[model samples]
Target chain A: MARVATGDAFTSTQRAEIDRAIRDAETVSRLEFSVYVGRSDGETRPFAQRLHAALAAPARSVLIVVDPPARIVEVVTGGEARRVLDDEEVKLAILAMQSAFAAGDLAGGVVRGVQQLAEHARKPQLRHTD
Target chain B: MAPFHALLILFLLPAGLFLVITLLVYLPSMRHSEGYQPGQVWRGEPEWFGGPRKGVEAIDETEPAAVGSGRDGGESGRGGASGHW
Candidate 1:
């Protein structure tokens, strides 16, 4: 397969893999998932929050921000998303990603982290509506 | 040994072996050159996947305080975690 080189943090194939992971996560959790791979303007936490706030529907969104140069990874869950994914759950995902990043697998870390988050936030199945 | 045999043993064999060894050692590193390494300066532009295409630009222009203010509602429902490698 030909690798498409883009002037971006990830190669085209890597981006597509992340996109698919996000899509699957969204499908499972019924929440929007966005990934930002780049340097933050200031503190990574606040920058991630702002990006989360900018989403079309902040209440149902999850934003993952990764700053490779700074070695920072932040996950921000909006109003509604926070309900299903608490701080503890997010922390678990963060740890998983941190280990992967430590080994220089940026795209792989993001994909795994997103998938883990979605699994944790998966909507409860309705047994009966009667 | 004949001239042809000596040439094959000393020149052709070593040249072939060197070429093979060089390729084996160099190709894998080239394939992995794009991966991010800790402490390496990042040169790529920022990218947002699954984010609002246009709204994100505007967020960067607004005062950081205003964005922070969004956290003030009584619910303060936003939650997440951060980490470093």
Candidate 2:
């Protein structure tokens, strides 16, 4: 696991990983990926909204927010993106991340979630009829 | 001019100076280098990671179908305005 700075900011390595996740999602599908981490006041909804606005994807981005200590995870997909990454798929990714979080593995959770998104987004190669 | 007042000032001066120095000299540079501005958004560009270049046509054409599958899951309503914590 990579070491992240303890402050409210993400380390360079963590940012790089996030960038990679976005790329992975883009490769598998058109849906964009963005992650937000910080302390929220009372609820995580506002933070999630802020993240959604920050990413500014073309109505097809997935925003994941992890609030510290509370251990809550919020996954939000834009209108167009929601069409491809259904609730079940999002739940599966969240479950995978939850398992990693239980083990005190933040990096692992993000990595696994990104990979799952990629796999879920993959399109099977078209078969050709001669 | 009590002894306690002298002692209190003596103790506070150095500590205050140290905090001021840390905040003024060290904190800003740290935040800037780490991209830690308040209310600032970090944008991830897909092109840098060898993904589809912005403004270019995507090679993968199955995105619409995948999105359609997600839409059919019937949880679209739940997705709106739901907070995790």
Candidate 3:
């Protein structure tokens, strides 16, 4: 599909892809994924956390907040999300995001980060060990 | 000290100071800087990379995103982490 202008973080196409990524992440991991990009209202962490808290399923949601001008990227996962997605794993996602953000690929950074989070949060296939 | 010795000290002091200042100013920043990666196409406008332009299709600005078909209800219990780069 052709790209359309969207007066937000990403273009219509970019938003569509990001939305798709979130869909895939949720499908695989059974967790909620949210990406918020914009100039932070204030301190990024608090703003991001607040955003996370206000989600439909905050307890199972993962919020990725990116403040480009401020150069702050926060990944706040909910209770269950953290249980599955873990700190070290999320940190890995954050590092991937940090690299992409540093390289000036906001959309790509978000996409990679979301994909990483989903992979980490994915439920492992059970193995029958006798 | 000899005139030559005094001249050497004078030159050395400034040169050494310059070197130290340069190190102090640039080293930490360079260390902190994320390593260069080539070719990342930013979406939307140049400024969009800076942050969300508007949060267009976001669910709740307080929270966000598009999720799976069923309502997973990904609630918040003060879980997760945060950082910057």
Candidate 4:
């Protein structure tokens, strides 16, 4: 994992992984994934809405926000992303990332979060569907 | 040697044991969820520093040096104007 900078600025490598994570999410669910890193006013609901608008992904899109200095991670999903990803699923992803973050594993958190998103977005096979 | 030495040894033992448990037992399960590798590049343009305008335009102008130069100047000018908003 890369060192955490004083601010939310990601290392070049970290930024690349984040972008890939979003892109992978888009590919799997055909939904836009936007990540915002900044401080929120100790509130998550409004921040989630703003992220949802900025990405302009379908209501089913996913938004991940990290207030690094504050050690906060907020994962929000639109209606569509919700069909496949429930609150519990999103929480699990957050929990995974949270553990990594607490362990000083920023890269690990991002990779795990993205992986969780991809897994949650996975379409059931026809056999499974039936 | 001294009482302090014995106390130091007692403290160190538990600390070492905790570290061992954390590294040997807990770390593997945590490591398993780390799915993607860091530094993996994506298909889209890289995000530039500053705001989306700076990041997006810088990425858009990466090709063709001459065009990129002109676009960079134009973008900077536009960026200056937008800052006033």
lDDT per residue for candidate 1 within B8-50, as digits (tens), equals 9999999999999999988764565465555556777788899
Question: Native-contact fraction for each model?
Answer: 0.66, 0.09, 0.31, 0.00
Best by DockQ: 1
Give lDDT tens digits, candidate 4, residues B29-64.
454433222232212222321123442233233333
Model 1 docking tier (incorrect/acceptable/medium/high): acceptable
> B-chain TM-score, every candidate?
0.40, 0.34, 0.36, 0.33
Interface RMSD values for the candidates, listed in order?
A: 5.1, 10.2, 10.6, 14.2
Cα lDDT over the full model 2: 0.57
What CAPRI class is candidate 4?
incorrect
Ranking by DockQ: 1, 3, 2, 4
Provide the TM-score for each candidate, comma-separated: 0.76, 0.54, 0.61, 0.54
In model 1, how large is the Cα lDDT of residue B75? Answer: 53
Give the range where candidate 3 chain A is weakest over 10 consecutive residues by summed lDDT: A1-10
Q: DockQ (C-alpha) of model 4? A: 0.02
Off by over 4 Å in 1: A1-7, B1-35, B61-66, B69-75
> What local lDDT score does residue A31 receive in model 1, on the 0 to 100 scale?
93
What pairs collide in candidate 4?
Answer: A60-A80, A60-A81, B48-B55
* Candidate 2: pairs in clash: A83-B67, A84-B66, A84-B67
Error of 1 at B36 (Å): 3.0
Tens-place lDDT per residue, model 1, A7-107, is 45776678889999999999999999999988899888878888887778877899999988789999988878988998899999999999999987899
